[model samples]
Target: MRKSRIARSGARRPAVATGAAAVAAALLAGGFTAVPAQAATGTDDPAKALHLGPKEKLVPQGTITDADGTVHTRYERTYDGLPVIGGDLVVQQTRDGRVQDVDKATEAPIKVPTTKAKVTPPAARRSAESLAPSAAGGGSPIVQDQAPRKVIWAAGGKPVLAYETVIGGTQPGGAPSELHVVTDATTGRKLADWQAVETGEGNSMYSGRVKVGSVKIGGQWVLRDQDRGNMQVFNMRGGLDEDSAPAFRNAKDVWGNGKPTIAQTAAVDAEYGAAVAWDFYKKVLHRNGIKGNGKAPKLYVHYDNNQANAFWLDSCFCMHYGDGLDNKTPVTSIDIAAHEMTHGVTSATAKLRYTNSESGGLNEATSDILGTAVEFYAKNPKNPGNYLIGEQVNLLGNGQPLRYMDRPSRDAEANRAEGWPPSADYWKPGIGKEDMHFSSGIGNHFFYLLAEGSGKKTINGVHYDSPTYDHKPVTGIGRDAAVKIWYKALTEHMTSTTDYHGARAATLKAARDLYGTKSKQYKAVQRAWDGVNVN
Candidate 1:
């Protein structure tokens, strides 16, 4: 029997690789073309380089200017006047407007038949309802109509014309489920179904008596932030519907008593978490907000009846948190909040698929990486920055962290003893059976090795003994440099379908861009991935 992998501590494990020459192939598949850092002579319009014609329209989304003066302009594509879901691409150019390279999600020619849907909206809704799992406790299921879009479903041989229908409703456990169901436009056959909600947990019990933002309206203080996009925290009061939850109110700006008994206390932690996350992104990453548009996502705390999970819903562009175990333990820690919110960042940028084994693992790991960076950025005394994830929640009864980045194998051993599947340390056969949370160990381990190096070391008073698959030791590049490389890789290099091998290439490219190709940081990134057996 395969060994069960378990995390050593924390309330819940954060749910969430490849080769060299083969790595180049994966990068090319993701639409990345690495060009040498040299100025192009011509004054070619970057937009014109897209070669968009009358049948195809390109809508400018955003522009990212790298440290090397390379400008990356992103665009959303439309073919035949219909929005293409995966038809987004980025045009890279020099400061002189000379085209450098282009990275796209799909290169398949969008040559589908008539955009008119043969299947009625009602028919698509019924087809979606038939596939949705029943809610727990026999609660009547509610489904919302999502705007249908013309998309190219390319999973099967050739890209085919499809109508994408989204069905959003409550799950059996009171968790929100947003199902993306794709149906053939002509045949009405269900092509694919993917859940949009990414579920995890956060326990407010860890962050004790943190300060929260509030505004005094009329006579009472409410959980509204005058700063940070005026993001407000709402109290579900054990309810499931977010639309009905009332905004948390207080007599004074000071909130929470460092105890779970008071719902307001959890609200304080949740708001503080949001504020910290917002500040981290803006101050460190230069991102204005989660969407990079100076907008804050609505935060809902105390959701459902002891839901014991937290999730980021792309449909609502909101973050929802659940109360764990008897509605007392609210999942609202600093790392958890940052982790869930980072999902939004991932969606906005790479839009990595949360279902594909390798891509899903990358998606989860991006959250962990950014979330950890947020913790260190905050540097709160109550929750000092550490390599351990979800340490404050104490989800395992024992005072252990959910997952140890310094030594992910520790969680694998715990998982094995607990009869859980083995964590994916180095990719092996049957790895798909491992939970995304477990497969994330490989990434967590890789980052740790990259930032802190391999072998025995103590960070923030915690001992870590990391190992390499080839029994080779690696030197550290410091977390600061490591984070910049990772952030650039995620935003500028990687795409939705990028897997482990692709990640290896992306980070290397990021490093080369930031520090010259022959820099120690670039070499360190290679060594770190090698330590994780990604080479």
Candidate 2:
């Protein structure tokens, strides 16, 4: 047997690189010449350059006539304006075969054009004055025959676009929400009018863009408005948002045979888990939820065959569960659901890319931390949950759990026996898969210290405590403060390459930022990290 991988393997695992960037660079490398920064000027043609400031009051030039009196030429700037910082000029311009005439000019800004330039074929006429500040740069441009669409508002200030969206209504089959709010990047606040199109044919429908920002409902990056958010042609594949396949779905009737259906059972588990996560984050840690968007969550269950795995596909904006064993067992157990969904939370914030050794482990550890916190939140009797993974699944018929945070290596295959030494592999980058499932023990151990308050304490009938790498009996910060510190650290401070040590520093910094630098929470995080040998 493959020694039973972590039941919630997908929870908080680091993201894997699919080599997409390299492929894009390769494709664009051929026959590509860099466009010069500046362009030349011509008669009847106004000088154009990328401006670093706000909109300029320039009455653009019209088409140029040829010898036969037929119009043979037209031109427009690539963009209305460029980025501005302080009072520095950073505009790029191109010139065609026209007479350079600064003296004979149309209505343009007071700034002088740059000396350098490039020339191109005649094109469309432009009347736009100055470009807005928010419309600057992003991914590389695709220079094709057809130009992309541009939406501009005339308020020297940028405009926000609102929309009439129908979300999950009072009734399951009722009209969805009629109003959705998304801000225009150009305009910093909410939109004045709804701009999104009405989309979707049924319950599995919505309209908008899946973006990385705060949502009214509170989940991070689930969805936002189409405007301002980068429109990636590739995002529709598993994207979530106000305009995505509903992330939350009833997992009933998942099994075709209708054997031992746990639809409602699983639904209750998922809801309860989500509720616990929300409460734990709010009441305890002061966090909202995955990315702290404070948005109502969306979930999905009963995914694929009798798959024995559950995961939070961040791109999909939903939690997926597997029907275990003979299809009677739904992996929608509270811990499993909480564990998987936490991955979304982690990704939206820390986004610790799953590749690399310790990064994967950190990802898994994040799920473990939040999962345990949720279980502790529920405090159910029959379900009597704790920090152990897969205890409810009975995946291990012998009553042995998939992982024991108190002492992870006891699971046999984890290879994380107590007192293991930290090495370079633990710090490598892009070692996603291996670090997630196996090396997660380190993070698990840190959580045990933070939650249970380390040093020879027995948790739920298991007598255990992890000693620091220095073989010292380490103390812990109470679970309450630990959860908050970890959350703040992940969301506000940590980056994709952060690891155990980085996590420790981030938690300490977050604690300091949230509470006072000398507050108990900050000290607790510092002590906790020190106990784990991260200080």
Candidate 3:
């Protein structure tokens, strides 16, 4: 069956007769959608077991229309040992009052604040350079504040105490977004103060502090940290599910002009990529895991109709992958997953801005760097790790990879040319039309030079070398040193407005700070810039 996009409308309430009991009765009555008597019982199909016990009732009623135009009236019930309320237990019913697919809904539960995990080797916090408007005495001041203490519950876990805050909001010019501040209460140290866009989906969409904080906006409250688990998987056009779960349907051809289906081949690549990312954080960065909270990583696939893009939506706390339209293919490859998830780690740590050219490029490059690293780490047979982007999605249909990190201009849209001022190259304003993901080529190329270690290098039969702006050989930096430098620059020193030139300078300084100015890593930072053609 085809899934339908849900439409939301303004809400109305009914008049109630009286006291607590009457209020409870009225609330429950208003909660669920009215289901026909026949639909309340079992149907011939086992999947249509849609009934709620009298004692199990919590809501008065509610209903959601599924993709197929079928009405699913959901009610409070006990399914799988978990309490089902509100939109949590939906049952599809036909006009004739017969139930359709009635399985325990897997839409995750709302997170409660609670945790025992201590903040691991804490990360350094860097102040954001004041937005121009704020400095000019225009918008709200974007200030860095410490996280506050509060209680929260981790998904599938008990409540725990944690720290959180709204670091900066509505810069002096009143920028449309706010920077959420999160940290470890026990240590009372800042962890991350990052930007977040409101989803407009009401408090329920976001699991924790945002909801509570919204209750008393102008006033302050201690925010409790809720652990958003790592590893989110979605049933896209083609996805796998347990035997008893409802298989996603109405598979369509989004990319490759072929029906989207989970091939064993693609599955192997995804699994390997996810595993490698998990390991990289554990081994290389010594991160407890994604989000530094030791939670399982999450993977979401098959998003949007004929959509050819992927992004990490900070509001949702998960990575999203999309099947390409006519011009692109499904981006459910392993490297893609690793790349998207790394954005989350960055958000939880550095919180890089997606706007402006340099930050935009860094956003894309971070994913690419880690994506390639994860690929190399996995060494999958179907998709051998390489410095290529979207190799498996086959968007080009000619079996060519998308975006060459060593030379981002390969895509035409990903113009990697530098030397232009930030506005000329960075702020095109449209979302990805010619924005962050595309202009990111410059930084991506820079990273490739930094990683592959300054020169023409070939892997798995693909050969390429770094080029300078004047079409000459740019030289500087070793791969190992470049990684260290960039990572330090990103997590320790760089800010949202930091541009490519700023990045070069910051990494140079970070190298000197981490290793003496005469060290190999220090020189590597300089060489990496030379190799990327950056003066």
Candidate 1 — worst ten consecutive residues by lDDT sum? 1-10
* lDDT (Cα atoms) of all candidates against the true structure: 0.70, 0.41, 0.44
TM-scores of the candidates are 0.84, 0.50, 0.49
Give the per-residue lDDT of model 2 (tens digit) for 187-279. Answer: 233222210111101000011111121223443232222222211111111221224334322233121222234343333344445555666
* Model 3, total clashes: 45
Q: Candidate 1 lDDT, tens digit per residue, 1-535?
A: 0111111111111111111222223223332223322222233333234554456655555567777688775555556655555566666778776776777666666566565777776776666566544311133334453435556565443567776665555544456655567777777777766556766664555665566778889899998887888899888888766678899877776777778778888788888888998999888888888777777889998887766677887767788888875678888888888888988888877777765356677788888888899999988888888888887666656766678887676766556666665556675555534556777777888898889998898877778888888889989899989988998888887776676877898899889888979999999999999888888
For this target, which candidate reaches the highest TM-score against the unseen true structure?
1
Candidate 2 deviant stretches above 4 angstroms: 1-259, 289-291, 413-434, 514-527
lDDT of 3 at 276: 62
Off by over 4 Å in 3: 1-232, 236-272, 326-329, 413-434, 453-455, 470-478, 531-535
Please give the lDDT score for candidate 3.
0.44
- For TM-score, candidate 1 versus 3, the one ahead is 1
- What local lDDT score does residue 12 receive in model 2, on the 0 to 100 scale? 23
